[model samples]
Structure formats: C-alpha cells, structure tokens
Target: MAAIEPEATGFEPESAVRKMSGFSLKPAERRALLTILCALLAVRILAMFWYPFVDSTEARYAEIARKMLETGDWITPQFDYGVPFWGKPPLHTWMSALGMKIFGVSHFGARFLFLIASLGLLAVCYVWVRKLRGHDLALVAIAVMASAGLFYGASAFVVTDMAMVLGTTMSMAGFYACLADKSSHRVWGYLFFAGLAVGLLAKGPVAVVLTGIPIFLWVVIGNRWRQLLRLPWITGTLLTGLIALPWYLLAEAKTPGFLNYFIIGEHYKRFLETGWQGDLYGSAHARAKGMIWVYGFIAFLPWVLFAPALATRGRQVLEIFRKDRTGWHSYLLAWTLSPLILFTPAANILPAYVLPGIPAAAILLVSVWAGIFGQPGRKTRAWVAVSMIGVAVVVFGLTTVAFFFPNTLNVRSERELVQKALETSPDIAINYWGDRSYSAEFYTQGRLRYIADSATLEALKSNDVRDALAVYSHDIPRLKDRLEAGFVDLGRFNRRHLFVEPPLQ
Candidate 1:
C-alpha cells in the first residue's frame, strides 16, 4: 500500500489562463465579473438572515443541532427530548452545533456550516477543474454551478447534501489529481482517503458506494485496474477508519441497537422497500423507482435547458469518450451517472440524492461547450459577461422577493402558528395539538409541547396553566370543540387556530 507512482490519468497540463478566462480580465469584463461576484455574495448574505427555516427538513436538522447544544450530548442526535435519531450521522449536527456555539443558536447559526461547506465545494471545483481544463472552462463550470437553481438553494439550507457533496467531490477530485499529476501523488492520495473518511461521516456506506464505485468502474473500464495498487490504500483505509468509525462505535455503545437501525433500517430497507414499514422514525415517500433520473433535470434547472445546445456537440463528446486517453470524459461520465444508476431502482428518492453528482454535471456541461467553441472571442466574452451579471441580478431579486413576501405559500404557516401561540401567551405554556412543528421548537428554543389527544387536552383544561397558549387546526372537530369551551379564540394563522385559556383572565 505504499504510494506508488501512478500512470497518467489521461489529462494534459493546462496552459496559463488567457484574458477571456478573467485571470487578467479586460476593463469592462473585470468590472462586470466583480459586480457579479459581489452581487452573489450580497444575496447569499441576505438570504442567511431573510429566509425562513423550512419545516420537516431544515427545521428538523436545526432543532437536532439545537438540542445537541441544549443537552450537551454530542454523540447521539436527539429528535425529541430523549428520543434518539438514527436517520443520519452526527457530522452535520455537530457542525451546526459548533456554528451555534460561535454565532448563537439562530437560523443563520444553524445553516452557517452548510454555507461554508458549499463555498468550499465550489473552491475545490475551481482548483481541480482549473488544473485539468484551462482557466476559462473552469470559470465557466464554476459560474454554471453557482447559478444552477438547486446548487444555489442547497448552498444556504441546513441539509446533509451539501456536506455529502463536499466529501464526494473532494474525494473524486483528489483521485483525479493523483492520476493527473504523479508528482502530487502523496498529497492527492492522502486527500482522497481523507475525503473518503469525510464522506463516510457525512452519509455512511452510501458515500463509498457513490464515490468508490465510480472510480472502480472507470479504472476497470479504462484498463487501469493496476492503478489501484499504486494508491495508499492501507494508510488511506486506516485514516478513514480513524475518522469515521469512532463516532459510529461510540454512538452504538451509548445507545445499544443504534447500529442496527442506522445501517439496516435506514440504509437498506429505506431504499429498497416502498413505503418501508421498517422505518421507525418517519414514513417513506415511496416514489416510483428511477424518479431520480427525472429529478436530475429539475435539479439542474436553467443549465439543463442548455442540453439542446450541448446536443449539437454529440460527435465531439463521443469522440472524447472513445479517444481521450486521459480518462477525463470517462471519469466525469462515471461521476455523473454513478448516483443515478445506484438510485434508479430505489423506492424512495429525493433531488438531494443526486446532489453529490451535480458538480460533475456542471463541469461536464462547461467542458463540452469549451471543447466545441474553443476560446471565447469578443462577442462570446460579452455574452458570457452579460449572462453572468444577469443571472446574478435575477437570483438576487428572486431571493429578495422571496424574503419580503408573506408566508402565504403555506410553507411557513406552521412556524407562523407557533409564533402566534407564543405571542398570545408568553408567560404560559405554549403547546400544539394533533401534530408537532420542529420549526416551532427551534424558534421557541425547544420549549414547545404537544397535546396528543382529547384526553390530554381535557386534562390540560383544568390544569394550573391558566391562559396557556395552544395551536391546532380548525378542522379537528374534537380538538376544536374542546379548545373553544376551555380556551378563548385568539387568532388564526393558515389552517391552525391560536387559543388562550381562561379567557385571558
């Protein structure tokens, strides 16, 4: 497992960046590029503060991290007060907790690490692609990634997909570096393994499957199987084990049977079984198999629309695939297709499942365009500059509007209802009936309570908690009737009603 000098990965050294690449940008283009970057940066910062925390997903993760911060238990992710969450590893929660510690427990703090991971992923893409392709193509790819709808949205959200993408992309890029530059073998080899470790922490075996399988398949197809021996697998494996295993082992030791649920129930059955009955924490989506393929286009929106333009380069792309000895096309194809292939037969699917491969798709799209068009001429540069500025403007305006707009979309109604309850009775206990809102828990600092049934509501009616706040849907006839009798109607938000008991004294 010693670091052996690996054979060429079919990449050629790129030349110095030219004027069109923005390395030494022309006056107008430089101003334009600077404006675009500044605009994007401003919008991202504004989004951090302006956007509402989404329910069921974003708020769930933020609450778990908040709970971790609250209870001082960093090992097991807590779904409720004492309920252990085995849905994902603690890496994401741990990162957010650290963010909360630094920035205070708030929405921005919860998503801070995710935003950093997204930016780091982009930086990695820029450096890696710049080394393989010329500066112009690298910049194009980076621009496309930054402007892509899903990538842009995922960048600001508190989700595991961005962290997962960071790990997988880092691992793959490191491998590419090892193959592309023999002199950098030790550095890139170690990076590859380090990323593998990160990926494991990010999403468990699925990371290995998504990343390792693609590299393995590409090597086999390219007849470069022997290159595997050249990698520092022994050291790499040890490093990965050191970083990823201790958490899993410690979590299992703390909570017996965690490993069983996480690995088998979450990883296996959740994917293979439609409406998976084994899921202990939540129900499965059970979308038709291969829906991920369709989601790919949606996730790659605005850019995927350019597929027709890219289609004209089919002969060029095919030739690159058939003739390129550097394995560039092969590696990209593998990277892009790996997740789609793996998830194609799965019962449950989400756009985030295809996230790790998005960077690859963007890179591939730009590379094909670069291959066909060669360097950008004056007209092309002007168009590129305009497009970059225009997209940035649109994204900034869209985010601004989304922020100022009311939560009429119903997306934030649950949060609004919870807020209303809190506003109604700050001194009394604020609770919900019928269901729970994790977002509410996050906003209330985990003080929100749930009244499960009529029995609980009846018991609470006479309890010393005079003028307590409660939130429930008006459609729940039983709960509604009981609420009206004991609690004065305060107000309404969306379909949920806010009530204050004892007629507010």
Candidate 2:
C-alpha cells in the first residue's frame, strides 16, 4: 500500500484528470461546429452568386476596377469615358483589379476578391468570438452575421463596404488581442499594423478613428490608461502614413481637386451637410432619430432578442464599478457606445457605415446569451429556433426582391447590349449619356471608343458613323442633340435609346 501511494504521488491525480479532460473532444460537439460553419458558408455563397450586379454604383465600381486591370494603370482609376474620376479610394479598386487579373474580368471575376474578403471577415469574426466569449457563442455570432440581410448584401457586392468591414474587423481583433494579453508585445504590434493597413485599404484615417477611439477609451476606463503610452504610437502613425500617402499623392498629382473632392467634399461635407448631392446620400436618406435604431434592429436580427439581457449585464457592470471600479465590462461598454455616438451625427448615414460596431454587438450578444442561458434548455432551443427563422425570412426576402424585380437597364445587364450596339455600328464613335457610359466601356472591355459631353461629341462627329452607337437614358433628351446628322435610331432596348450612324449619304 505504501509503495502504491508513493507511485500515485508522482503525478497528482487531480492534475492528471484535468489534463486528460482538456484533450477530450466529444463527437457531437465536433459535428455541431462543422455543421454550423458549413451551413453558414453555403447560405452566403448562394445569395452572393445568385444575382447579377445591380446598376448605378455597384456596377460602376466593378467596371472601374476592370478598367484598372485592362489598362495596367493602378495609379489612376478611370470610368469608361477615360475621365480621371476619384469618388472613392483605390483599395477596393486594387482588390478588384487583382481579381480581374486572376479570374479574367467577368462579373464573377471582378467581384471575386470581395467575396474572398467577405470570407476573411467571417473567419475573423469566428476567431474573435471564440477568444472573447467562447466556442459556442462564436458559432452563433458567425451564423447570425453571415445570414443577416445587410451583411449578406455587402458580402455579395463588389463595393467598398465589404472591404471596410473586413479591415475594421481585423483591427478590432488585433485591438482585442492587445488588451487581453499584456505579456506579449507582438499583440500591440499586430494592433498597430492592422490599424494602419486597414486604414490605408479601407476608409482612410476614419478607419483608425473607428478602431482607435474605442480602444483608447477602453484602456482609460479600465484603469490601464498608462498602457496607452506603451503602444508604438509614432511608429504606427508613420507606418499608416507610409501605406496611405502614396495613393493619395499619386492620385492628387494625376487628377485635379482629388483631395478636395475625396477628403473635404465626400468625407467631410457628406457628414456635415444635409443636402450633399450625388449618389452618396441626401436628406431623403438621412433619418437621424430612427434610422440607427432601425438599423440596429435589423443588423442584429434574431440575436437582438438578447439585448434586454445585455442591458441587465450592463447594469451589473455598472454596479461592479461602484465596488471595484476595474473590469473588462467597462471596456466593453466603451467599445459599444463610442462608435455609435461618433457616426450618428453624420449628415449622410447608411446602414453599412456602422458595420465596425458589429463586433461589439456580437460581444454584447454573446455575453447576454452566456448570462441568461448558461446551459442548453427549452429557452435556449426557442431562442435558436427564432433566430433561424428570422434569418431565413431575411435571406429569402432579399433573394426574392433582387432576382424577381431586377433592374434590367442597370449597368450589369445593359453592358452586353452596349457592346453589341457598339460592334454593330463601328464606323461612328459612340457617345454615352448619363451613367451608362461607364458600363458601356466595361462591357466593351475598353475597346470601343466613347466620348463624354458635347465637346467630345463635336470632335468625334467626323468619324465614320458605322463605328459608333450613341446611348442615352430614356429620361434625358439633351443627349439626343449631340447625335450626328445622319445617325439613325437603332430602336430602343432595355430602356436605353441606341442610335446608329448611317452610311455616308
């Protein structure tokens, strides 16, 4: 007995038991995790590939990126008409350009990079939730985010929003790592690098604002204020400048008023001025009082049912402050509230503008779910069922709306028509009216020469009529004035007026 007891003493039985427990993975749990990730990805891919690109801005962005690839000019982004356009930063264009290069410039090819970026976002969210809450909550957060209508829409399109979301989420994940793990200096490096890279690639300095402010506030409130100085602020700032400055500099040199239009006009004026014109947003789109709440409700659907529980947890965090005044909960509150306050005052607001807040919302949701339903039960099952149904309805509704009531005249659908019209009448140079000019260029793969405005029309009038097709929106009659004298109407197609130049009289 004494010898047996000595042998047992070589390793503590409790320690051995605990170590063994860590290695155990139940078959059912593994199955559940795989099933959830696969299902979420399936739904996302289906919705993304199901519809062709929509007209106006979405198609325009993709077309511009395609041109960038075709021309081999990454410095200056161009529309179909070859004008120096700088409405948005070049990160999205760069990504799309790469996609075009790899995938050969189809709609799917142009949007492929964004799709990959969206998947990166999903992967980041899963890792982030697992680190912050737990594995179970990570699954729920990812599923909810992947299925949300807005998220799905953003993911499917080749717009800047998805890039912004992916970059911002990466910054947040890096920031969280910095806060959670103090012993590792690499964590702060990751945070700084992510912030800088994302800032460069996404939305300029605003990316840093969206990411840094919350982190700063969290550190200060957590009584880790001094830790701020520990981060490599100077190096990080320099790095960010290095990454972001070249594009702006090159763009400014190539295009006049680029800085003013992008930084001051688009970013600043759009936020402060109510009636800022153009496709960005206007008074009609701005609903300050109710839009955030509505967006909040919609963005966090199914999971929003746990908001009351989060409120309760927040109250508990407040009470804890009364006693100890130091905890992660305070940091969570800061992270959640800061961005909401910052973006709410902007003159132009879209639901996607608040995407950076999704991570915080996910964290809060996980916290509430953990507090209320710590273990599986009837309540948990009910919550899960309701969430699944809510997400299903949103996904189905979006698919129905996008596919059945398609905007056929949009840049996406009308591209081929423009191409055919151009090829059919190659003797005359085509002039495009309204926004269709950009899509026409994309469809022709930049081969068909196009002129913008009456001046270009006047210059090109002497060109052979058979080489050109004039396309104008049905709504605008002034474009008809630019048509050459002998041009004949080629009949209307897809709500666009096409004119063909006749053979010389």
Which candidate has the top score in lDDT? 1
Q: Taking the tens digit of each residue's C-alpha lDDT, what string does model 1 give over 366-465?
A: 7766666665568666665665566667767665655555344455535566666666667667777766677778888877778776687788777777
Q: Each candidate's TM vs. the true structure?
A: 0.91, 0.75
Model 1 scores a C-alpha lDDT of 0.76
Error of 2 at 504 (Å): 12
* Candidate 2, superposed: residue stretches over 4 Å from native: 1-33, 79-82, 277-290, 305-327, 382-441, 447-505
Q: Write the per-residue lDDT of candidate 2 for residues 346-405, one digit (tens) a residue.
A: 766777766667666666555445444454455665566566556655665565555555
Position 220, candidate 2: lDDT? 57
Residue pairs with backbone atoms closer than 3 Å in model 1 (clashes): 9-326, 10-326
Q: Which candidate leads in TM-score?
A: 1
When summed lDDT is taken over every stretch of 10 residues in candidate 2, the lowest stretch is 1-10
TM-score of 2: 0.75
lDDT of 2 at 34: 58
